[model samples]
Target: MEATDCRRAFPSFDEPALKATFDITLVADKELTALSNMDVKEEKILESGKKATSFNTSPVMSTYLVAFIVGELSYVESNYFRVPVRVYATPGMEDRCKFSAELGARTLEFFEKKFDVPYPLPKMDMVGIHDFSAGAMENWGLVTYRVVDLLFDEENDNANTKQRVAEVVQHELAHQWFGNLVTMDWWDGLWLNEGFATWMSWYSCNSFYPDWKVWETYVGDNLQSCLALDSLRSSHPVEVPVKRADEVNQIFDAISYSKGSCIVKMVSIILGEDTFIRGISRYLKRHQYGNTETGDLWKALSEESGLDVAGIMDTWTSKVGFPVLTVSEDGNTIHVRQNRFLATGDVKPEEDTTIYPLSLALRNKSGKVENINLDKREISIDLSKYDASSAFYKLNADQAGLYRTLYPPERVVKLSQAGADNLLSVEDRVGLIADTASLSVSGYQKTSALLDLISLWKNEKEPNVWMEMLKRFGAIRKTWIFQPESTTDALKQLLGELVLPKVNELGWNFHAEESLLQQQLKGTLFSSAVSSENDKIVKEALSLFEKYASGDAKAVHPNIRAAVFGAAAKYGDEATWQRLVDVYTSPKSSVEGLAAITALGGAKNVDLQKKTIKLTLDGTVRSQDVFYVLNGLSTNVAGIQILWDWLREEWDAITKKFPANMGLLLNIIYICTGSLATPQHLKEFDEFFKSKDTKGFDKAVSISRDRLVSRIAWLERDVKDVEEWLAKHQSSTKL
Candidate 1:
């Protein structure tokens, strides 16, 4: 049985007295070993030609913590006292699984040290499942992991993937305390459970692996997914009400995971890090093996830190969306205001009177201040406090707070001029640059400033910071004001001035036997320069691509592939697109190959678009490929007819084979039905939409209303149309 089905098959109460043993028996396929949560009390090769391993009853815990997996399992087994520690995965993935186990051991060790308690469970077995629906699960003593989330071969794993695996394992292990031990009383406190664990996981990873910049990545990259959703009008607070299991799953999104974790980070920042840890330790001790609500956490925190935890968290946890901190300074005083910030083109913001629990940090010529409250909607800090009036001042300093900043155009210019000399964090710098791009600045001037900022980061920052800056600069490079040639030069100049320095300074060498390209890849984008004086950037990237494509090739980094394609599609030869398509269609293609296909299709290259669609016709592509081809095809006239006809002729077969994958197809169908509808095509798509004998129409509508249509709204940037679409689809489009 599937895990959730197992929960339903044996329902039990959450009451303290309700404890019982469960004996589950299922035939295991030959590829895997049968395993469960407790000690191996019984093991027998049955008459049915199956090996059955029965685990003794576990401690009373939440049903969601239960796990079972069948896979080609190799194990690294040990013991912490009587409790066995076993980590298992598919045979080839054992080394990375071992690393993951190491991370878990370290985290468990830390928790044991910090919590002043012994390891509670009698056995801990972590198994990496090939097709897990979520990242990882904390199942009392039996944690299950996604293959990608657990296995990390040191010799083959990229720096970034290794770090991500470590953090994912740490996060799940932490749940043994925050979630599995002291459960949330209801789903409204789900954020507290998830958020606390997410934060602690990163904290633990950072403590173990300092170079990873785990927190920065979590803030800049992952947290944005949550913020993007939360910025929508339909968003709820991190701590949201979930009266049913379906409702509980709905909040298991970026908001509950990343943004909710960010809030915990903010709490750590606001109250000192030690204070937050002390509070959490007190919380776990107070509620050990019991259930707790959001308020229970607040009570423990308040008692431990002697802070007004309730007042602060209540405003943040119950409120929907984040504030816009608009800061301005004169010769005497600095002004800050609390307001909602929708992206510049967003329509119909909520009522303006809602207040955000604003955390303020002021850094003059000196380092950052502890914390100040901008409790009022508009508050001013007197700049007469022993520093120059025009000193570097950053709002939402160090990205500690969860709001967007509204640095006006003049301030952008000033910061651009200041460059890396300013004290803002890399994320804050990214926000500043993005904010500048969104504002009403002259395109050429913005380009120059962006180039300057990019130059500053390349020259002075770490790899992660450099990557963030490259992404920001690359994002706005192709705006309407600059010709592709001009943008290419600017990119070239930015990349050109830096490659040799990086190669020589960082000792990135490529010998015949040990090419740098053979290194396990990291990151998900690539780019290069083509200046007359610095063409090595382009040449090296192309060389790497070619080397990576050779039969004995190293695994090409996802970031490198994205970067190469992005660079090539913009300015590299047209032949580069053909090479990409060739690799994508090849039988040797992996998931990265699919990603390249998606990126190329998303690039809006007409020829590349046709090639992607044609791949599906060969029946060599995955189901997702069909969706990408369809989704990409939706925007164009030539492919739209092909798409419409396919929907008409093969709609039933497609839905029958892949019901869950039909949503994006239907969404594209919906949009095309409205605009490009022929009476015949419209009838077909409409019938397909209405004739859902399966279980995904609401999901289809949700996809359209939440992701697809919202993107179209931004592309169209027509406020009235956005409002009309929202009105028509209010029931289905809750972000």
Candidate 2:
């Protein structure tokens, strides 16, 4: 029910602008209820003793959002401003459906209020299916979700579950207004539909679950995810022009969902938040039940704010990559320059003149603030108005701007010092760490720069900062794990010193009153500890796993179970692995099942890890969930080699078994590339992916290839410094 798949479901013109009214009728078992976009028009028993139901013709809408479901589904019903709202699931899942059902109703009301448009449709139904894939489908009045994304059992579910379900509900509820009510004119403008939903959903979810800090989570999850992928040479322009239907799916990536929304947020920063919201409200009202391109939005926003949003944002949408700002202070003026951002360290000749009309946030020497807008290739902002001879500044204050920031050597030292003093806000910390991580891997900046920054922020306690910092450590670890034999011990020893102290500070115990993020970060911290050969952390993790396995403890904190299971598998014997298998066989929730599936990648021995990979291709792992194993196994250095070998051995069978689902296929190849430190590793990975039908994965393959490019580049640029640092830090304990 996504993109261009509507033609297969019904006979109709599938073009987005060729809207239609669907009059759907379904015949099913007499006991089952039928639902559709509109209220039921008629229901009767046919001569064949089957129930036939017809729905009222829906309002004019695109084909993809037109949907109906017939099943023995029970509902948890509620109302938002008198419109009936319900969440449907199998009879046994009624309790689990309650949270999303209520949230969906409230979210519908929230969007209505925010967009200044009433809900065009009569009712909304969010159905959680047992076998639903692609995360969640925003199917108009009939939003469909996987069980894990929609349902949360009050007793068994934790904060993560509640937060995820509420956010997905908010996400789909947003589509009801943006995609269903007002559609995109063409596939080229698909970002208008998705980007609007992504941006508003975060605001809507924060409207309800302020305590969950959904907006803050967006900075970590969506913004950072986009930054990581968009910096690559393989990344597509946000407003991509497509000629084939097959190409459309590839464009529905992080670029469309996350980066597009980030651009929208960056626009909001320029246009004040209230002014931006008002512009969206007016745009939705003006274009109600119609189509729009990127320009329409800019027109509405520009008219409201008088900021010439179109003039600025046109480059952002049309360009394929973002810029990395080199913020330097000279005399009394601050200079901001733009260049093509490339993780591979080589910009094509065509992109050399690329410049961005980016925004900058600077502080005066007295801590007074000034904002500058750069429209040319490079510009300088005069700080004489602030009455300061010397200016102190930080790029991308609050991390609202969606570009990387580089600092001079002296600036880096000052920023690192600021990080230690907690002078930087939480968002600034996330931004700095993410930029440093990307720069270090790409060889634009040395590994020592990133290490110095993280060293200063090792005591950082914010959830987003810590979570992002842990992921940065993964990148740093991958960069060094395959260095020359002379530097191997030094690399591991340095990582242990950097990470194990944090693990000790946050032990195995989960406090009842801790924030949900604080709880989850413990697992991230512990896994890093295990990866670096810290025995005390591993021993403690195994002890907790053993106690939880034999029913000795009341229950393990849901957040730490995967880390516990992974640690057990990596450091324990056969019995421990069997216990994890049992958890997979009989999971209390699909949430638990996923943790078990990922833990399977952490097998202690490489041979055992290969067997797990075999199990993944067999009936054990669902085809949709193979990404979890590939993604999880990337952390296990031994498992990374095994996954690559498995793909090479089973490429043909994999293609046949999972046809055209390049997301799953490319993930296996993508994870393998992260461990690429040698030319042999690069040759093996690039050759295999190139030999496959990677049409849906051109971007993914390019990303994996670039990871190798960056790693090789890093080895050339930074390994000498790494060797010196490692020699000083290396201990007797071999990792």
What is the overall TM-score of model 1 with all chains considered together? 0.76
Model number with the top TM-score: 2
Candidate 2, residue 197: lDDT: 82
- Per-residue alpha-carbon lDDT of candidate 1 for residues 410-486, written as tens digits (9 for 90 to 100): 76666665556756666666555544433222121233444445554555544445555555544433221122354
After aligning candidate 1 to the native by TM-score, how far in Å is the CA of 213 from where it should be? 3.0
TM-score of each: 0.76, 0.93
Which candidate number maximizes lDDT? 2
Give me the runs in candidate 2 sitting further than 4 Å from their true place.
328-334, 365-368, 381-384, 387-391, 484-508, 661-663, 672-674, 730-735
What is candidate 2's CA lDDT for residue 397?
71
C-alpha lDDT of candidate 1 relative to the true structure? 0.58
lDDT (C-alpha) at residue 543 in model 1: 64
lDDT of each: 0.58, 0.76
Measured over all alpha carbons after superposition, the RMSD of each candidate to the real structure, in angstroms, is 8.5, 2.8
Residue 723 in model 2: lDDT? 71
Across 609-668, the per-residue lDDT of candidate 2 in tens digits comes to 776787666877777677777766776568777777777888788767665543455555
